[model samples]
Target chain A: MSQERDTRTAFMEATYRALCTHGYADLTMQDIADETDKSKAALHYHFDGKDDLFREFLAYLHEGFAETIADHPEGTPVERLVALVRRVLDPVDDSADQQFNTAFMEIKAQAPYREGYREVLRRFDADLRTEVADLVREAIENGQYDEETDPEEIAEHVLTYIHGTWTRAAAVGADVVAMREHLVDDLLDLLVDGASVPVDVDATEDRGLAAADPDEPHENSSEDVVDPR
Target chain B: MSQERDTRTAFMEATYRALCTHGYADLTMQDIADETDKSKAALHYHFDGKDDLFREFLAYLHEGFAETIADHPEGTPVERLVALVRRVLDPVDDSADQQFNTAFMEIKAQAPYREGYREVLRRFDADLRTEVADLVREAIENGQYDEETDPEEIAEHVLTYIHGTWTRAAAVGADVVAMREHLVDDLLDLLVDGASVPVDVDATEDRGLAAADPDEPHENSSEDVVDPR
Candidate 1:
């Protein structure tokens, strides 16, 4: 890598460490500098100030997120979606990742206030929805989903579930681990008819009904219907 | 009401007005005092400080939310659940309420950082889930829903949708009014089988399918069948 690019990467890495230690509210450039081999003066040369550096950090995180999504491409749309969520939801015992998740929530909480954050967040949300919508399209093409399903709304549904999980994580004592175990299967059932995961509902309700009506098709999710408005 | 209680209520109302103006980050006691006819000294006399006053404001809001839920009991569980969402989503174009929603989101964003906000938020979320779970219980008892469905998970699904809507509203350019029109029927279909609403889904997918599968019975959502976890 170029020397300039290497320095920038190191700066962000130091900032991540400092952010994990002091959190967003108490994070300081000096702390980040101390976390790295770079002197405080060296840190000041790359960015204008704290907000500028933080904005760059957010950009870095967004790029990383997109790369993670691109790197995992080994399964069907439903399996891929579930795997993506599981990867995020079932992180190993990594305190840094947990701290990063907490800090990310703090940053997201600012999306309404900061223009930079808003643009990045809007794009991120839109990108996620687009990916899910594409998956829905694939499912429909494969005859696993109903032709009448509104891909955008299905996309929104998945995004909403993910957002809700984030919301609960922000709350005290949210059992993300337990919810992770159930959410993916629930989502699969919610999205594609007869596509079963390991959830209990599959055994009693979905499989039972699948047996009863062998030719029943996928559900249209009600959002695909006419609009009285 | 007693004079003391009236004073506290007036103080909370004034705080709400001030918060809507300055937001949570920059709010000051002087700003709140200016919003009320009461002097700053009188405000200080009632509460120890800003944190104390803000805690009371949250409590007031929580109480108001509880009252709002209790006051609206016009329909069946599914209908009542849909109506509750509609009421929150389809407010009249009152800028004050809109501003209040924005301000409420700001305070909610602070819950992770502030103990007072965290407690209030936890209670509010728990209460909402409890109410929905009780409604789900009623649906089962009345034969409107499947007997084997897990009320807690069903409740979580609805609350997650609402929470996700709140998250989206915190973003810029969120078209909540447009979403409110469709989400109610979408939610109904996910939770209960064969229940129709005013949404065009009633005319298209739902009612059409209700007519098609006259004996298809209720969908227990597959995830409800077995809980290995």
Candidate 2:
């Protein structure tokens, strides 16, 4: 890489580390400069301010994600998608990634009140949905998935599950990798086969069975359907 | 109610509101006092300091959750459990609930660094797990669910999902109720019938196939279990 490109990479890495450690509220440009072994002026030349730096950082992360997806080997779409999830959840050195996750969430929390931030987040979210949806679409086209599957809804579900795992893991001090593994397993299970009902009920009869009183006799109910045994 | 009981309730409510509005770092005893229209001396008499006030607040919220579960109607375990989830995602005034959710996350973020805060969170998580686990166990006992289900794991999954939705909704300024409904549907789908695989593969064949192609293979392969196309 060119010297300029190398310097920018170093600055981005340093800023990411610092933001993770100190949080967005406490991070400073001087700290990034010191961490990157660059002068304050040099750091300023590359970025306008903290908000600018954060925007660039987010872009960098997005690019990294895109590269990860691009690098996924040709396979059944489900396999590649699972690999994508495993890669994202893989452990990194120190707790820097955790900090980054927290900082990202903090920024998201402020997005509603900050229009620029909201736009950034909205674009990022849309990008994520698009990427995952494409993969789902590929799976469907390949015939690995059922014809009735909805890629957009599945994408939303997967992304929501991932974010939820991260936030909950952080909240409870649980191992992110373990929680993620369990979550991915659950998600894959839902996607591949779909939900099953244990007791076979006639569709018309069972429509609102759960909504009715268990004590109330169903007009069409039989011992077999009720499973009284 | 007794005058002392009313005063204590007033003090607690005021402190909860203050913490929600101003956050932990900016909240003060004087603020709670002013909000409650009580003297600082009276506040001190009720609680020792900011720490004590927050500790009490945590306990109150925890107790409220317990009360909600207790008040769930008599029915099958699944119905009761669903009610528990609905109550957690209850839509109060968004203005107030948003502040509460924000404060709740803020305190959770700090739990790792503060022993007192960590203890409160630990207790809260443990209580939730126990309550949910018991419900799952009851369901199994009554044959409402399969015998293979692990209550602890299921409880963890449920709690993780709920907490995740709470933070994600707050982050995006979305309607929490709608988020909860979507989550519940997805979760129920997963639990009612275990995650389905597109096709059942012979275990030994699947293992060898996955191992042989560490990198996903594209298109037609001898071991391609589910034909995508």
Candidate 3:
């Protein structure tokens, strides 16, 4: 049993490495087999086929994402929330998280009809939200947030933005780093208890800096905010 | 050319019905063929395979979603915004929009991996955001929203929530109607310029109504919000 477990772990690790290297659509069985010392027969013996391997891989991915919640970075609730958002939304790495997200979303988009995908994702998503909710609840208790803030609602809101960024980034192939830095991360800033929403800050800051990039959205002449058709 | 167009329309309509009824994962060529008088060979002839058929089906879906933006309903910007939100987010019926969204998201989930799916989804998504941004811009110009409002960010923010809700709902069977009424629609409310964010209101209401569902996360006692570790 212990030997079998080692083989399973090896295959799982090999699958991850191959997925990251080759990507989901282009990934081939030999790609994963290349990472492992095991022969293709050994790999096939452990998993019936690609979908079977992917199912286990999906489970493995959940464990990794769920740990982000469990690891619970050290900081005040707001700081932790920032870290969580950065971990989930910000593209701090070259393509690790982004690649995972795009692939994860590709699989996730199938959740509605694929019961297996649906179940794993449902549990993992709920856990992630609960983690976020706990943080918001802690913030409120510590008085970082007003007593009136709803942990569930705020958790859902923040998760919504983070997840939305994932889906959009995956779909549109945007410069996520710029989008997050210049556009997205501020959503996290908005939740810092008494943090100013920066609704007007961008407009005023950009106007005086007239040297600001002309193509950027969010801040510009009100007349130009939406082009007239 | 006209004969080709008719055959294409018939296949698209059949695909829509088949997807809504059987869903994406279980969608078989036979299911679509059953919907139309044409033979399965006809569908195969029109498109190379499932991917090709789905590509055209996606274009059809975009035209449908894009029309919502083009067919701007007559009303105040706020009313129009609400109507737009309702059109996009609210599950109007069992089949029309919600079914399309669920099936559409299934295909979209593949966008992260499929370049063809990504391109079409990106274009449609950009157009949708532009529509929302336009509405916000008009609201600002009409003085419904403060001049300080950033149309692009606000549009992205709103679109993020809508898109996130769709993904979440697909992953987990959710009471979207309650969530929309209680959560998502309120995000729209925050955009009403001078309107109050329900952050405090929901908490206060939930606290007063203490009879609110115990399983509900935000409104309960702080102790209840997080299960004592």
Candidate 4:
């Protein structure tokens, strides 16, 4: 069982590398194989096919996200919320990271079509929403936020902003790190009581927001999707 | 030339019908042709292939959006902004509209891989941003909004919200029409001066936000993607 788990981890990492390199539209078992020591035959042995592999891959990612939330550092609800946002929106400076994000967006775009993918993404969305809602409730209970603040509504808006920021970042290379500050400030101003929450985010550190041209086409040098045909 | 333009319009409409029926992932030239009076060979005569047709389709959609903005009802900047938001987030209750939205999102997800799609989407984003920014500027000029309000920043945030809202609406069937109220309220509370810009929105009308289970998976009675392979 332990050996099987290690094999799956290796395959998941391999799949991630492959997706970053080739993207969803063009990714193949062969590409995944190139990222791993395992042969294409080995991949076939592990999964039914590409779709099956992708479904499991999304589940893996979803699990990872849930785990990250679970293992968040203990802090005041406000701090924990800020930390969560920061962690999720941490700047995508490296080409590999950007490529991976692009690929992930591609998969998300297909969620409407693939039930397996849609299920995983749905669960991911629900879990995140619950986490954010719980935190908001905690903050409200602790008297950090305004008494009238609706935790579910706040969570919904926060998730919307997060989703929007991420989509724009992946689709058009929008400056999210800059947007992150705006999001944090907006939440604090809207929810926090007067002179209660300290703005602890560092605005000085530029997180590669200026690196990419906002108007440039999505086809960057690092992440070009080859035509599978 | 007029005849040629009519023929192109027919094809574009045909493509739209096909996309509404068969999503981007499974869409084929034949499927598009099936929607038109024209044969598959006729579709080939007009364009190189599926990608070329899709590129033109996106351009067509972008142009239609621009025209829609131009044709917006004459109102104050605040009213116009609200109108625009209302129009875009117009209660997507009908299954046909829902299917079309899902298909459109699938195409957007593939934007990273397709330069033609990316270009069209980028132009769409820029045009929307400029329009929102200009409205915000006009509101500031008219003393409807705070003088301290940065139009560009407001536009960016608005676009992000729009993008995010669309994504969540498409991805998880989130209550957008309900969220729409929150968005309008947020803008008014944050930007508009006290009792200056009237909350002109009709909040009483239920626009299908209460129709769907927010936690339900995306696969519904409508909008199932058929795998071509």
Best by DockQ: 4
Q: Which regions of candidate 2 fall more than 4 Å away from where they truly are?
A: A1-11, A28-30, A36-56, A113-115, A190-229, B1-9, B28-30, B39-52, B190-229
Q: What DockQ values do the models have? A: 0.24, 0.12, 0.24, 0.27
Give the winner by TM-score: 1 or 3.
Answer: 1
Clashes of each: 8, 6, 0, 0
Cα error, candidate 1, residue B211 (Å): 18
Q: Order the numbered candidates by DockQ, best leading.
A: 4, 3, 1, 2
How would you encode candidate 4's per-residue C-alpha lDDT over A96-124 as one tens digit per residue? Answer: 88888878877876777676887888888
Query: Candidate 2's error at A214, in angstroms?
Result: 35
Candidate 2, position A128, lDDT: 66
Where does the lowest 10-residue lDDT sum fall in candidate 2 chain A? A202-211
Ranking by lDDT: 4, 1, 3, 2
> What tens-digit string does per-residue lDDT give for candidate 2 at A13-102?
998888777876567899899887789999999898888877777677777766765566545576566556656565433677677766
For residues B1-229, could you state the per-residue lDDT of candidate 4 as single tens digits? 6988999999999999888888777789999899988899999999999889989999999998887555555566766776666666666778778778778877876776676788888888888888878987888787677666677777777788888887787777777777665566455543342433334332222121111223221122112111111
lDDT of 3 at A131: 84
Between candidates 1 and 3, the DockQ winner: 3
* Chain A of model 4 scored by TM-score: 0.83
Using all chains and alpha carbons, the TM-scores for the candidates as numbered come to 0.80, 0.73, 0.74, 0.81
B1-229 per-residue lDDT for model 2 (tens digits): 9998899889889988887677654578998898887899999998878778777777877787777666655566755665566667775465777777766776666555455766667776787778888987876786655665667766776666677667766666555655555444432332334422222322122210012121122112122222122
**Which residue pairs in candidate 4 collide?**
none
Best by lDDT: 4
Worst 10 residues of 4 chain B by lDDT: B220-229
**Model 3 pairs in collision:** none
